[model samples]
Target: MPAVTVSDITTLARIPEPAPSAAERGVRSVTEAPTGFEGEGFPVRRAFAGVSHTDLDPFIHLDQMGEVEYAPGEPKGTAWHPHRGFETVTYIIDGTFEHADSHGGGGTITDGDTQWMTAGGGILHIERPPEALVASGGLFHGLQLWVNLPRALKLAPPRYQDLRAAESALLSTPDGGVLLRVIAGEVAGHAGPGATHTPMAMVHATISPGAQLRLPWRRDFNALVYVLSGAGSVGAERRPVRTGQLAVFGPGDVVTVAGAEHQDARHPALDVVVLGGAPIREPIAWGGPFVMNTRAEVLAAFEDFQAGRFGQIPAERVPHGDLGELPTQPA
Candidate 1:
């Protein structure tokens, strides 16, 4: 591991949108919400749980995947899409996903599976909805986060890591009602999920209502939280933060969440992701499906993709994934 640096660990958290007050709020219910500007075909849904990308050092985008229900027996496909200078991490909470990439390696990711892919330099891929979801018209819920690459690895080769849910080590603390699932980096005295290519921390936490979570913070790293499901409040922000929204916190000693009571009896848990890391601290030149450091670099990437530098996809190629299918929904 490298020594920590002030420039690398300094993070600023702000409540971009303060959570709603459950006390003053009226009874309400919401199902599918989507984020991200309109993507290509299929009306890229911002359907409603939160979707936005604030500051995650070296990371740019975060989309709260949904229970995308497709027609019976007809698999939903996102044709091929391209990405550069970043890696994509897909964490499945339920359902199944099948991805294929231009990098030449891909497989099915069922419930409890995680796929970390590096689309260094450039790659094209497609992620198709699992047939099971189409067959049963059930729910497909998960998250896909785009982690930007430091300048050093911007042009590195593309790669992938498929770790199953059962294989991923977990740390569950009943005392505080905290469930920490480590996707990368160390948490709660546990280590060795194989180091993430980027120096980062990705943890999925299920905070029980009235439970509290206090995580150590090192200056220089940016921090943000995505409320996955249920309603809850955060530090300095006692309002309710439900699905489909993000809480950008202000810099401080630690992040605190209190005064959240589950709305449903069967589901008394509040789910969210605590992601923070040193930012790349570089310019973001983004266009369509590509992200790079400069406009010129962005142009070059499109040229490569258009010229077929990255191979083509199969007949029913979907364009909603990065480098093909590792964790992309390239629609």
Candidate 2:
């Protein structure tokens, strides 16, 4: 097969998005990520907890799409779907995820591990129940971020970045707060990870209950927070976020978070994700599982995937081991 171009996926994508002014870029004050997003056909259960590229950038959506706790044998996965032009990153904090795609690239993602897959040009894939997680019996928690590749890199090549827990840095604060720094330019005066293909801010933060933290953000980037475990407040404005909720900030160079009464020492584990990125102020054309700039380029990606262009298997030396088979749907 060649590749599936945008024409193959139809014009159902490229839906209009909100365009705030440049003045609205840096978020100093914080606010909730909202409850009801009208578009996107999936059941809008708060399961889709992601930050949309509403203003400062074109990073698209960042969903901390944690799974609902199901019984031992319930269906636990996403059906097969298609994507093109963009990329999907799966970061696991707990539980296991087995994934496969049209490219013959598939594997089991364990806790504290990450898989970066760029669906450049075109590709079809799915994510669902993992024999490992299903057997382990616990809540499934992770983040799936969509990073838009610049037009030049959109169709260049599909790639992967598999990071093990020890391979990355996990920073600690004096008050027992931990941050698993994954990607983007840099942090704490450290240089960029060189792991990510694009500049991004992806950190997993967990503070003991009642701890306070103040973090820096460049005046040029877009930033936000998603509360995972304990409940708390952030910023001088003091916005509250429970588990599974996102708090987006407006125009600020740094972020200040204060622990709340409920986040007392007794609770201890308060989980949160500190995520942000500088905006890619370029044209954006997105729909379904893919994202690209121009409609023509989108069509081209669809055609490539449909033609088997984007489905090439990774070489044996790439470290993914044997991925078994090409999956038309998620397993």
lDDT: which candidate is best?
Answer: 1
* Tens-place lDDT digits, model 2, residues 32-123: 44443211121122422343456536466665544445457643556455676677877776666766776766677766667778877566
Cα RMSD of all models vs. native, in order, equals 9.9, 12.0
Computed on alpha carbons, the lDDT of every model, listed in order, comes to 0.62, 0.57
TM-score of 2: 0.73
lDDT of 1 by residue, 260-312 (tens): 76546634667777776776677778776677888888778777776777666
Residue-level error in angstroms, candidate 2, position 178: 4.8
What's the residue-level lDDT of 195 in candidate 1? Answer: 51
What lDDT does model 2 reach? 0.57
Clashes within 3 Å, all models in order? 43, 40
Candidate whose TM-score is highest? 1
